[model samples]
Target: MQQDSTSKDSRIALGLALTVRHDGHGGVADDLADLAGLGAWLRAHPGTVPDTERYRADEPDLAAVRAVRAAARALFARAVRPGEPSPADAARLLPVPEALRCLNQAAARTPTVPVLDWADAGPVLRREPADDRADLAAALAHAVIGFLAGPDRPRLRACHAPRCVRYFLKEHPRQEWCKPSCGNRARVARHHERQKRTA
Candidate 1:
């Protein structure tokens, strides 16, 4: 396993941005398409999106989160500048300034209170939502901010294999595509292209 000291929330930001994935059938799939889907996604990420086990999701919350996702995706496109962005959102990306405003607004939606404590390791400080009930959009936006501004920012990459629309952290020096399967697909596609040219 690749050892990384990145904070869980920062990693969670990448997860949040990846909620929109390429469906195997040449289309994009959104995990937050409905309240049920949103609820399930939240439940899957326990502590990061707290209170989701019994939490009731509504249309407004879903809409808000989708908006946050748009902003995150746009900023992700900016992060990979000079490189092609994920084809999934390439044509639909919001302007960088608008994306920035949207993300900032969502992040500020929830007020956080800092807490200080002593642990076995040492004194630690953390922040908690003021109301104790976290805003889904705010939490995700915060994570997006953390990941994009953290050390791993430079490692973010968009996979370009046929019909694949995903972003991943480049794990090693030789890494190219997001996964080995993507590499295989790319190589196969390249072979086909070479054959076509020769034929």
Candidate 2:
């Protein structure tokens, strides 16, 4: 109940965005990281870095991504509301339905993870597909979406760090931070607190 409607929507949208990027590419791999970067950039909002070599910062597509993020955030806000709304209440929000539809579609197609071709001639020797970079990029996004909407929905969560804009799935219910580093940072701060108390 305490979760603000906007926050919930943002969390869900963020979850969807993150879901679309989990292509098993790796931390620094081009294909994988580009999708991940897009997810991060979406949450960050303005001043997004759209690498042309990777995702092509063309006007229409980039605008589409930005709009999607905005719609998603708005959708989350609407989703966490406490009750049913009147007809007039529905009239007040136009984009919510479309946004919800997008999320639903993303969720519906959300797969566990994409199967890699792994037959490419890259230095890494992974099989690569003949699809162009943009298609591959789209595939990454689609895959992320599918996984999030799948059976593992509950694991999705926003970053616990107040100002950080990131989303991650909790491996455990008690997990509070987005990344291990964030958790460790909190732990180290706590260690100093305990030390001061003992002293």
Candidate 3:
């Protein structure tokens, strides 16, 4: 299949940005769990990620996942347009699919969640991030979304450090440091230059 470089980079960057590790014992902090939950979503649905166990019950709610997925689709759909994307164009970009899923999943269970409170209101049960894994999940998801859809969209990019897979928005297009190895290489080269100059 033909690949869309821009979209692929965006997805990978967002995925890496959203990733969080889970303890699996349910004793971890909500914020960390939420972060991992967001990562899980990215893994599932870069196309249609599922709600993490941290966010959902054992049986899993297919309906909840689908609902969040749909909202994410709409957000992305509304954000894109044909033109030379300006800095403000970042604002035009909606939260990607993963962010929308996190938020929607949170909203499905709460009316006063952090980001969801001012945005939408309904029964949603008013659950806390601790009580509602969905809330934390949503927050992490939205973090990447908000970052990607800001005036800094131009900085968003994927890591190019050999086989190391990660994403980074460059501070300058000329900067190529993404992993420690890459940064170390650059540092070593700079040290060599300094020695040669002094010699």
How well is each residue in 64-133 modelled by candidate 2, as lDDT tens digits? 4544544444443344244222221233233777865654553333233344554466433332234333
Q: Which of the two, 1 or 2, has more lDDT?
A: 1
Model 2 TM-score, 2 decimals:
0.39
Candidate 1 clashing pairs?
Answer: none
Task: Choose 1 or 3, whichever is better by lDDT.
Answer: 1
Put down candidate 3 lDDT per residue, 35-129, tens digits, no spaces: 34544554554332225333432213433333343343334333433312223123333456554656545544534434434436553443334
Against the true structure, candidate 3 has what lDDT? 0.41
Candidate 1 lDDT over 103-148, as tens digits, reads: 9999999988999999999999998888977688888888889888
TM-score of each: 0.89, 0.39, 0.34
Task: Give candidate 1's root-mean-square deviation (CA, Å).
Answer: 2.2
Residue 53's lDDT within candidate 2 is: 36
CA lDDT of 39 in candidate 1?
78
Q: Give the residue spans of candidate 3 off by over 4 A.
A: 1-134, 183-199
- Candidate 2 residue 46 C-alpha distance from true site, Å: 24
